[model samples]
Target: MLPSCFRNICKNSVLPKKTFGGAFSKNNFATEATFETKPYRLHKLDTSPSTTVTINREDAIKFYTQMNTIRRIETAAGNLYKDKIIRGFCHLYSGQEAVAVGIKAALRPHDGVITAYRAHGWSYIMGVSPLGVLAELCGRQKGCAKGKGGSMHMYSDNFYGGNGIVGAQVPLGVGIALAARYKGTDGVCVALYGDGAANQGQVFEVYNMAKLWNLPCIFVCENNGYGMGTSSERAAASTNYYSRGDYIPGIWVDGMDVLAVRECFRFSVDYAGSGKGPLVIEAATYRYSGHSMSDPGTSYRTRDEIQEVRQTRDPITSFKEKIISANLVTADEIKKIDGEIRSQVDEATKQAKIDAEIGLDELPADVYSQSLEPKIRNVDPFKPLVHKRLGAAVNI
Candidate 1:
């Protein structure tokens, strides 16, 4: 039995009476209710000036939980893809959780976010449900994109698509920023692209336009060391992606560190919002998975190298250690959070598997504006094409 004083304290406490999987109930502890403000020193990968990074205990736990959730969800996605549940090209954002989570942490709900094909984590962080992401992967009707978008095209409010075309989202992101500026809103658009996309001709074109208009946009290059199966060193003459935007000031950040990413993102967002024009941020991150599910991920990089990164520089593990060392939360609390996330992912996967598959009729829908009718080709070459009338209701 608990001590009388502790029991009374629990009953009288004004904070939210939530328990951590019943583990803290007996101890009269509330892990989520506790928070401690601490100064977080910034570590810039480039010569950019330093800034302070502050994280309270509550925020730390939240970040840890979010990162863990992304990791588990990606793991579940890999399993689903391997089992043939998810079709088409599926890219798992396993090792790069911190970048998405950290960037989202620094943005407002109305701020825009656009990224490349590896965007399940970004979708989730930008307010899309995990079940929606999983369903979209499985081509189910209840997906965020209604199963039409599939793995490379999930969209949400203020969160643009997982564009299949490399670097295509960069121009779209710039358009969003221009729209925001034209409307005189204090919103900034974060345009995220892979190292490979950074080399695209259109990206530089958009960069020139963005700087010319002084659009409140951030060009974030996720330099995961590899572009597809090729390393960045082999792909580009210079790997200094941050400085790629000649006139635009840039910052290089240690993307493996959540705090650093979050702090740097906050700074960039503020800088852009101040009408300083577009800024570039090159995040030195990594992806443990292959370019896609098909690649073995070991043909170019050795297994030892992958294992070393997982062992030493893993974002989730390192953040957990930081929290524990700071005495913010007990190891048991972190374990409980991990267990909860695993269960959540398991349930989401089960639901995604059983969800109804999208109907073929949806192919013609959403093809054009509601005011314009569009004709779709028939599967049979000899058959007449079907014309979908405008304003016609689609059966969900």
Candidate 2:
């Protein structure tokens, strides 16, 4: 007994009945399909000679589901912001879903990730649930950071904060890589920054150290054409960000193509893990929305330009076409997935709106270790608020 949408999609769909290596072979309600891997042209780096890439049923379905979920979640966030449910600096990851999905596909459970403010997609891809992300944006106690970290500061295991500062996450990512190396783990850290952050002096400094120490790090520049309101052309003197690493090897990729991104990141992981020093990847991507909810996003770029990209190069649409053309999944199945994701996002939004806000007493709890009690400023200048250090109970 299913709804009309579900019944229709499930009726004609061919689900795999046999098991492959003790795992079900069903792929999003369709037979497993594989496509020839498209050749990706790399910049200033040796192209992976391997000609073909394969998309297994499980991975294909997972990628599609995750990418769609991110899109829907971001759309819900934008709606919540418009309705005043979310406050203070909201950045949507509408068009950049491919990058997050692709990079995450190449990562292991122990691998770490850090990124800039437009990080809702990364947070979800890194293991934070959609509910947690929506709740965090809404400033609810059920949020990933317990409502303290808003849109720009959600954190989870192995995934660092959605840093508020422009280029600060770059160094923090290096630190995480250093920790992984020191701990004798094969884990690598992926540091993501925008094209604007590429010009930061600190990023270059970190590059030098990463090269000198041969840190297991991948410095990624998501070149989404524009940096906030200004286009990359106006902001950067030389637009070739991949080559900016100087001594560090670099790879430039088509960020809009998720398969391409996944391939490149796989190569990067191998490169860094093999002690080949750090590799910089410049992803040529674009964002459909403005820098933030405040910006109209139409002042600098023309409406037609955006429309053109959406029509021709949209990541999600392109992938969907590939899946269908390869007979991987029917259009009805994809539509069903879209409907399910939208419903899930809607439910998460509804729950986040009703979730309780964080209390004032809990504010000082995470500030310091329990062993070192610190006084926090209250309304009264002399009578400061004091709380037991969190570290006293357990090691931080």
Candidate 3:
């Protein structure tokens, strides 16, 4: 379906670019390297020496706080999963927080976003309550899903997500953009998917529709290199996932650095919002966790390789280093933020554990219309699904 999607991963190679060793102009950082086929580099399109897009100290601190919160929350989720506190296929966004936090930073409140099932960070960044997310993990009623949707199927206002079916959200995002256009609204829709989902046929279909309609949409491929344990090299014939959209202008971004990601997605949002049709961004990120909590991330790649990426390209640490080097923040300030985030996560987990009132009637509450009509029905018998069991019946 999505091609053995993330089964065999590319072994991490020594990328020539350093965390801080890129060519610097007045405001842009550029680097040259051969990757997959084309030359890879970063060009800051909107940076100007005089022009100010300066963020306040409070805002910078907040960005760091939120990102650290996401990291701590996901790490706690992993530990809880190991202890069986969280059930089901829980995907942890331990290393990919930069993509979500940075992009969301560039977005307006009304902008829409959708991503694959590895969606905890996106949800948290989109203002989904940390307690709610943790409660969902705990299967408590206080979760954003009210305990019905454990790790996936999470939704928040303008932030749709945790979609389980591979590539299914591509068309859904197109529909969201279509609705935005029909309403004559300026809201942009961001359709995010994994490298694995990039191979899904529907993604191309939606891209075609989006291009034809000139919809205000930005398609983001968070190419964390692997779909589950499978690497893009093994799964994709062409490793450059950004150019998959032939009609749209595509960009490759360093997803490890929040500022880089924010700049890139900001450009895409501007392009799409300016009626330039849809823009595609391939964010080259890496996921520290396995596809889910159970995969160990070791079956397809070596521990040394994973450690190397972590030691070399960790987004949070990279950003922290930049802030310190630029004198925007001190090391003590970062450490304080880290401690605060950990405390917040710990408190959120405590509240989530005690929030038992949420899940009691969630299943029966949202089932149908005021008339209580069933959303689906099965009239056919002798079908394999029907014969299997009533709950197991196929809707189609």
The candidate that wins on lDDT is 2
Tell me the TM-score of each prediction against the true structure.
0.83, 0.85, 0.80
Cα lDDT for residue 244, candidate 2: 87
Best candidate (score: TM-score): 2
Candidate 2's displacement at residue 267, Å, is: 0.9
Candidate 2: Cα lDDT at 373: 38
Better of 1 and 3 by lDDT: 1
- What lDDT does each candidate get? 0.79, 0.80, 0.73
Reference-based TM-score, model 3: 0.80
How far out, in Å, is residue 25 in model 3? 26
In every candidate, how many clashes are there?
0, 6, 8
How far does residue 42 in candidate 2 sit from its true spot (Å)?
A: 4.1
Please list the residue runs of candidate 3 whose C-alpha ends up more than 4 Å from where it truly belongs after superposition: 1-56, 357-361, 367-396
Give candidate 2's root-mean-square deviation (CA, Å): 9.2
**Candidate 1 Cα RMSD (Å):** 10.9
